[model samples]
Target: MTTTAHAPLLETSRALITSLQEPGGAYPASPTFSAYRGYCWFRDGAFIADGVSSAGEVASPSAFLDWCAGVVEAHRTPIERVVAAAAGGAPVPQEQMLPTRFTMAGTPGADEWWDFQLDGYGTWLWAAAQHAARHGLDVTRWQPAAGLTVDYLLSSWDRPCYDWWEEHAEQVHVSTLGCIVAGLRAAADSGLVTGTRAEAARAGAEAAMAVIHERGVAGGHLTKWLGTDAVDASLAALIGPLGVIESESELAAATIAAIEDQLCTDDGVYRFRADTFYGGGRWPLLSCFLGLAHARAGNTARAGELLDWAAGTATTDGLLPEQVDGQLLAHEYRTEWIDRWGPVATPLLWSHAMVLRLAAELKEDA
Candidate 1:
């Protein structure tokens, strides 16, 4: 399908995202999904902000970045405490770190959650810097918070935290490390961090890159985490929008091949081989991420095909569900999740954001 064929859905997605943005600049994960309602994840919002920004709707992303900055600033004391502990070799527990998602009011979720992922903070820094650069806006507005994030990440980037899927909390995820490298590079390059901070950011990125290269690759492609040979759809992001790894590099090609051969089908991209969450259905957002990597690698035609597949997942109402169970990996597990958390999250902001992002990239390439 051509970009023209998907124009209506694209327009609806843009409108939906801007409309659902909270007054405080937070983008709720999903407006009506039970487990996701009333909270915003930094990782999800950053990508959403990047998508909205790329789609030529700037205000929503700007507001979201402003909110991100405010949230980080509000936790300055806790951040300093965590940093000091790490510096002193007495690192605090994972729960003591910042949460993975927050209320729209910019506080930690009142409800329990898998709340200690570090990828989101790095993602926010990357997205905020990219937004400022893309729109030619000043970056200083968020510099203080970005610096705080850098400090927080530098302290605990080596620790075992949750992966993007919120599982494997005991292992160092390669995708999470990619996010830190991207964010640190952005902060260092965009002058959002300077002096000793800039040096640290650059050093931190290099250190993370070294670790990724040293232990994150297997069979010439990126792996799920350090010391594993399994591949994940999320790995495509490092070679794409994240821009941590060069898209044109040999390793990028191997990773794309691995994900395509293993996790991707004609329908969509699965998160990982072992994933059974929501019956391990294919995710439209992951498809877009793989599409992005393909586009950046100069495979426009393949990229367009992936974009079309993602668009096909949208509901008749132009809403994209988190994942579709039509071709689930573990079909038997579907109903129990449904009984617990209701149906899969529909009108997921991250899903819409990714579609917007890939659509924009394909249109630009065309």
Candidate 2:
């Protein structure tokens, strides 16, 4: 993230950020990186918030923050509109939830979000708080916009929309719940999710943690979901909040250790064995997430090593790919036909954004 070393990262990210935009402030469900394009989604918006916050924090001139504010604002009216329509009995057609997953009451189901996903609102709430805390409190801009996000998350916290994986099944999900936990803490710091909001967050987080206790092991690692002892790369969500992992906490250490053992490939981390249904593979974003976690946990040497690995994986044009080859060859599974961008070797916004955030953190702490 040094100015000169990351010039290509900056240029590439600026463009990707631009490409993610939709007219109404929401991002495309996914960039036409695959078959889908142009649908505004809750989950995508949540992850998008992570990247947009990074751009706002590190990308100079800071136009992206304004763009970021718009992203959340776009969802407010649309979501309410869908809910209102659903209540009126003339629900929006499910087909209308383009791109991917999402649902507002009786509205058409989400494009990609066929199932519930509670974390999208949580992620958005946390993202807004991050912008205010790291940068100046842009009350004029972020407060009003983020306020709505806080409200949305509060309303949705207790009621499960969907887990992060979008598995319609009702099993409690640690990743989504973790975000809700972190998001609640973040929003409360700003007094956004307080009173009833605070109570709901506490109740929800407690339930989720109880689920984690039942599902996750104390060996410093966590089971991907409750009741199944499987591991997943998605837990990278845990590392983003702050210095969470401590040497003394066996469960936390086990969780990180489990990630290294189960998910971390030479190239990067992956969700889990079951995630292949979505064509999941070794993910480039997971590498940076691990790196960020390492950095937060005070393992600078390890963090830097992983950071170098992540940087090296960037496409020639500097975009992060959705996943990397297990062989670490850069082109193992990358078929032009498989991707919508058609062999456009690119970095995922999540990977680059985490990198940028970590770099910023390193500098500030240094």
RMSD of each: 1.5, 5.8
Runs of candidate 2 with Cα error greater than 4 angstroms are 1-4, 18-20, 40-44, 55-115, 138-162, 194-196, 218-220, 242-248, 277-280, 326-347, 364-366
**TM-score leader:** 1
Per-model tally of clashing residue pairs: 0, 26
> lDDT of each model, Cα atoms only?
0.92, 0.55
Best by lDDT: 1
Compose the digit string of candidate 1's lDDT tens values, residues 6-52: 88888889999999999999999999999999999999999999999
What is candidate 2's lDDT per residue for 1-366, written digit by digit as tens?
A: 343455567556656665655433544444645533434444445555555565553332234344444555666775565545655766554333211232222123433435445565566556656766666665355555555555544444444344555564455666766776666666666655557755665665566556666655444476666556777776765764432234335665567778887777664677675554324556656666776666666776676666667767777767766566554333334453355346332435555555555555444211
TM-score of each: 0.98, 0.73
**Could you tell me the TM-score of candidate 2?**
0.73
Give the Cα RMSD of candidate 2.
5.8
